[model samples]
Target: MSDTKNKWHAIALVAGILLIAVNLRVPFTSIAPVLPLIQNAFGLSASALGLLTSLPLLAFAAFSPLSASVARRFGIERTLFGALLVISAGILLRSAGSAWALYAGTILIGTGIALANVLLPGLIKRDFSTKMASMTGAYSITMGAAGAVGSAVIVPLTQSWGWPIALSLLVAAPLLALVVWLPQLKKHEHVNLSGPKQAPTVAVWRSPLAWQVTLFMGLNAMPFYVAVGWLPTILMDHGISPEQAGTVHGTLQLTTAIPGLILAATLRRLKDQKLAAATVSLLTASSLIGLIYAPDYAMLWAAFLGFGSGASMMLGLTFIGLRTKNAGDTAALSGMVQCVGYLMAAAGPLLLGQLHDWTGGWTAPLLITAAISVAGAFTGMLAGRNVQLEHAESSSRTSPAIQSANALTAGERKR
Candidate 1:
């Protein structure tokens, strides 16, 4: 009976995680697949259209800190569950088609997403301390997969149901997540995730490794978001049909999902992450070069792009989990990275677009992106070292019962 109950709990957690993962990318990815139509409908300028595409990411940058704080206060599960409802409202409101309603709903969606994003790693650490790495890997996999679905399904769904119906379909994910997580509300209690023992903010701020990670996380994200936010358009710009293009874009993200799982299973085996970071960065660079200069090899380059993005996101997530010592540190470091890093990412898609507008080609912009990719790996090499934060909370403080309950990852246990 005890074993059955434990298994059920784990299943519930995974289900809730999957639903939350589905919610994470929809507000952002759904926009891109339908962007041109949206722009035409609203009669938005290119800059305004770019903002429409990027608003959620930009809001993620602005709201992650507050999101983290809310999680710290409300308990991650409650924050996640409640935020999902808010997200549902955001999606439905955005469906209603007024300019003010659009911005308002966009903020609600971004705000809810920010809370969900900030709370996840720490909640995983606190609850499934045993399966931290595995669960983190699982979360990352679903993220890419969901992103693929959101982009690829939009036009098809729109064809069948009209754009609003297709787009508002996103609200279902968060509502389902809330239901999956409902039972956990009374069962799991809050742990203080950002307490005083976790050193002052400046101490965390001063760590070179922290800055290195922030850069790695942010820059790596820039490309993926660019792909997520702009890739379909870029492909269409090259003469592919919207459906074929969405499929190709989806394939890239699906590629990201597959390798995320593989890399999750293997990152522990890697001896030097500098090598790991550089290798994936090189893969990403090669893929981009092929993409920019060799459009004929679309399928092949798509695979490479997927592989690189998957590896890069997985590594960044791994480093975030690896570098911190405890839940508080995880929360703090996560807040810093996601807050500043997401803001930086919000710039990538828009920045390259403006450049493309000015230069009359994606060539100059792609070159800049490739440089950023390499730079991410260079910084990741420094951040990915096996060193822990010098002043972060001790890992041993994780309740031993919780430690045993989840079969915590070795590195998670070691801290």
Candidate 2:
């Protein structure tokens, strides 16, 4: 009976995580397809429209560093639940059809996602410690899939039901995630609200390996986000119609989930992911070359890029769990990596656009992407090195008596 009950608990936990993962990208992605309609309705200029798209990323960089600390104080489950509420509120607020409401809601949505983004890896570390790679794959795949679906559906939904109803439709996801996650509130109640403070450790800013992971994350994101932002425009410049370009872009996003699903099914751990990283870099480079030179085969090149992008992101996320020894370090490293990494990624689209305007072609921008891919490969190799953070290392050195005492205290807190 106890074993069966544990299985049910695991099921609930997995459901909650997967549901939460789906919400992480949908709020942002669902806006893009109907952006022109939104701009028209608001009588907004190009700069205002651009700001709508960029605000979430800025919010990510601004709010991510605070998430780990918030989780530490409030408990991960409660923090994530609160994040879901924030997302739901943001979705409704953005759908209010006013410019201020739109920007405020977008910021709120970004803030909510940033917290979930930093905290989910830590939660996985705490709960699915043994199956890190597989569970990470599940969440990562769900995130990619949600983005694809959002991009695919939003335009049609807006045409049929109007923008407010269409955008508001997304609130259901977080609301469902909130409902599924309620079981965790009971678990949270068992957790003590406070703990004895420990000596402050040096920040992750001082760690070389953490920097490597952050670079790997940031570099991979640059090409992926750039592709997401401009690939359709690139395709259109090659003589494809807007509708066809949209189709290709959607296909590219859906393709990203393939490698994650395969990884989840086949391999969950790697001593060194250097070879995998190299594979991603090569695929991305080749895809970029194909996109620049062979517009007729855009679908095929996009498939390769999507596969590579998905794998790189999956590897980056996996490292968060593989490289950390405990949940606290996982949370800290996640915050540091995502906070800096996304700030860097947020610049990708703007820079790519500038390159295109300067050279009057897609070649220069893609060449930049190729270079970033090679750098990503190098960073991936460094981050793939089997190592743990300094705090985890020090913590591991504690005497068995002290370790036992700490475990007892943790167990008491559970009671």
Candidate 3:
């Protein structure tokens, strides 16, 4: 009976994690499908619309690094609960029919998402250390599926009801997540109170391996976001109808969810991820090349691009847990990785757009993204090594007590 109870508890935790993941991407993706309605509602300029879209990425960059410390001070479960409330509030505020509320709400939503993004890997590391890869893949799939659903439904809902009503409906997911996650607070409260008193002393920013992981993830993000922002326009420019281009875009997003299922089943069987990383990078580059040379095969290229991006992202998240010694270090490394990675992602679309303007063509921008994907293959090779960040010489500067604590935690995890 005790064993059965424990198993059910573990299952509940996994459900909670996946439920939170459902909220991670839907809010942001829901906006794109209804952008025109929003713009018209507020009489906003094109620049304002761009800023509205970019605000979330900016908030992610600004708030990501700060999440670890906040989690350290407040328990992770409580912090996440607070984040869901913030997300719900943001959704409501954004739909309140005002421009200031819209921007403020977006920033709030982004800030809440930043906290969740930085902390979830560490939560998995703490609770599901042995099953890190599978758990990462599961949550990645959940996020991708939720985003796809949000994109698909928002336009139809907006047309039927109104933009504000359509947008405000997103609050339901986070509210449900909050209900599903409530039990975790009680379960984790004791652990949080009794866990190591001293925070991680190893500086993730000072470690070379951490930098390699950051760059690998950052480069992967560049091409993925570039495509997300520009692929439909590129397709239309190549003579595809708007409806066909939109279908291809949907295909890209739907296919992204496929890789997480594959990786969840296969990632743990491998000794290291170097080859997997390189393969995904090559797929990304090949897809971009196909897009440039064979515009007629846009659907195939989009599918390939989606699979490559999805796999690369799942690997990057997995690396956060695999490369760290403990949950604290996982949070620290996650913070550093996402802070830099998302900033690069924010810049990617803008830079590609500028390049397109300067060259008066999509070829140059696509080529540049392809080159970055090729570079990511090399960086991924370095990051995919079967090594932990704590073992690095630069990370060895922790005090004797901290070292002993880490060793004890590592031993506990191993057992």
Candidate 4:
């Protein structure tokens, strides 16, 4: 009976993690399809819309560095559960009433997501050591798919149910995630994951390789966020209807998922991911070129961009796990990478939006995006090299409690 119960608990834990992952991006992406509607309703300009879209990302940048410390203080499982509740609250508050409510809710959402995003990679590193890539892929697929579906359906839902209610519907995801995550807090109540009393800290900001990974993550994210915030608008500019544009936007997101699924299968055999990273960047660049020069074939460009962006996202996450030997290091690197990376990412939509407003067209902005893709490709090549972050001449200390817990976890995983 004991063994059976433990087995069931393990299954539930995995289910819960996936559930939480799905909630991470839905709140952010759901707003994209209805962006134009919201802008018109609120009487917002292009630059104002960009700020609205980027408000969460700016929150992500600001809050990311605090997540690891917050997790350390509160316990990772409990922290994650709290984050879900916060996300739910943010979603509710976002639709509560005025423009201020919406902006305030978005900041709350970003804060919650920041906590989840930085901590999850470390949790996955700690728990699913052997199947890192596959697990990352699983969660990435869930996240990407949810975002796409949300984007696809939001506009139509707005048409039928109205924008505020349509946006409010997203609260259900985090609420469900919160319920599923409760079991984990109970299971891990006794486990001590807080690091050594005098833990050695690596200056991730100083490490060349860390910077490479951070740059790759940041650069790819810039284009990805830019596309999410404004790609439908760009398509609409090319004469596509709003409904069809939403569908195409959704399709682009779905395309991103395919590489994740494919790579999950092949990751076990793959030791080096540099080529994969380069390929993803190249595909995104090509897509941008197509979008700029061949506006008539926007769907094809969207597909290419989706495939690259999706694959790069997975690879960026996988790099975090692969480059760390333990959970603490994972957390530290995750925090650093996301903090600086997201700060850089926050510039994407804002700058592009301003550029569009100034130039009165998409050409300059698209060219800038293409340049970003090239930069991402270069950084990906450097970041994807087979190297671990702990070997960067940084001292590492492990507490006996952590080591014991790891041993026990490893033994159970073998079962």
**Candidate 4, poorest ten consecutive residues by summed lDDT:** 191-200
Relative to the unseen true structure, what is the C-alpha lDDT of residue 341 in candidate 3, on a scale of 0 to 100?
A: 91
lDDT of 2 by residue, 1-415 (tens): 9999999999999999999999888887667656656768988654465566667788889987777678777888999999999999999999997889988999999889988987897788778989987898788778878877777776677778998899999998999999999999776532222233333242577778889988998898888877776776678679976556666777778788888777644434566777787678778878988998898999899889999988888788778877776666666677687778888787776677667667878898899888998899999889878776676346555679998999999999999
Clashing pairs in 1: 130-407, 130-408, 395-415
lDDT of model 1, residue 218: 87
lDDT order of candidates, best first? 4, 3, 2, 1
lDDT of 1 by residue, 57-93 (tens): 8878877777656766676778788788889999998
lDDT of 4: 0.82
Instruction: Please identify model 3 stretches exceeding 4 Å from their true place.
Output: 1-15, 36-51, 72-74, 124-135, 182-209, 229-247, 264-273, 292-296, 318-334, 356-361, 384-415
Candidate 4 clash pair list: none
Q: Put down candidate 4 lDDT per residue, 1-415, tens digits, no spaces.
A: 9999989987987898898898788998778877777888888778888887898899888877777778777878988998898898899998886888888998899889988987787788878889887887788778878887888888888889988999999988998888878778864443334445333255576677778888899899888888888898888888888788887787787787788778766765777888888889988988988888897788888888998887887788778878777766676677677777788788899988899899999999989998998999999889888887654453344557777888899999999
State TM-scores per candidate. 0.83, 0.76, 0.76, 0.83
State candidate 3's TM-score.
Answer: 0.76
Between the candidate structures 3 and 4, which one is better when assessed by TM-score?
4
Q: After superposition on all CA atoms, what RMSD does each candidate show versus the true structure?
A: 9.6, 9.0, 7.8, 9.5
Decide which is better by lDDT, 1 or 2. 2
Each candidate's clash count: 3, 0, 0, 0
- For model 1, the stretches where C-alpha displacement exceeds 4 angstroms are 1-10, 194-196, 200-204, 320-333, 384-415
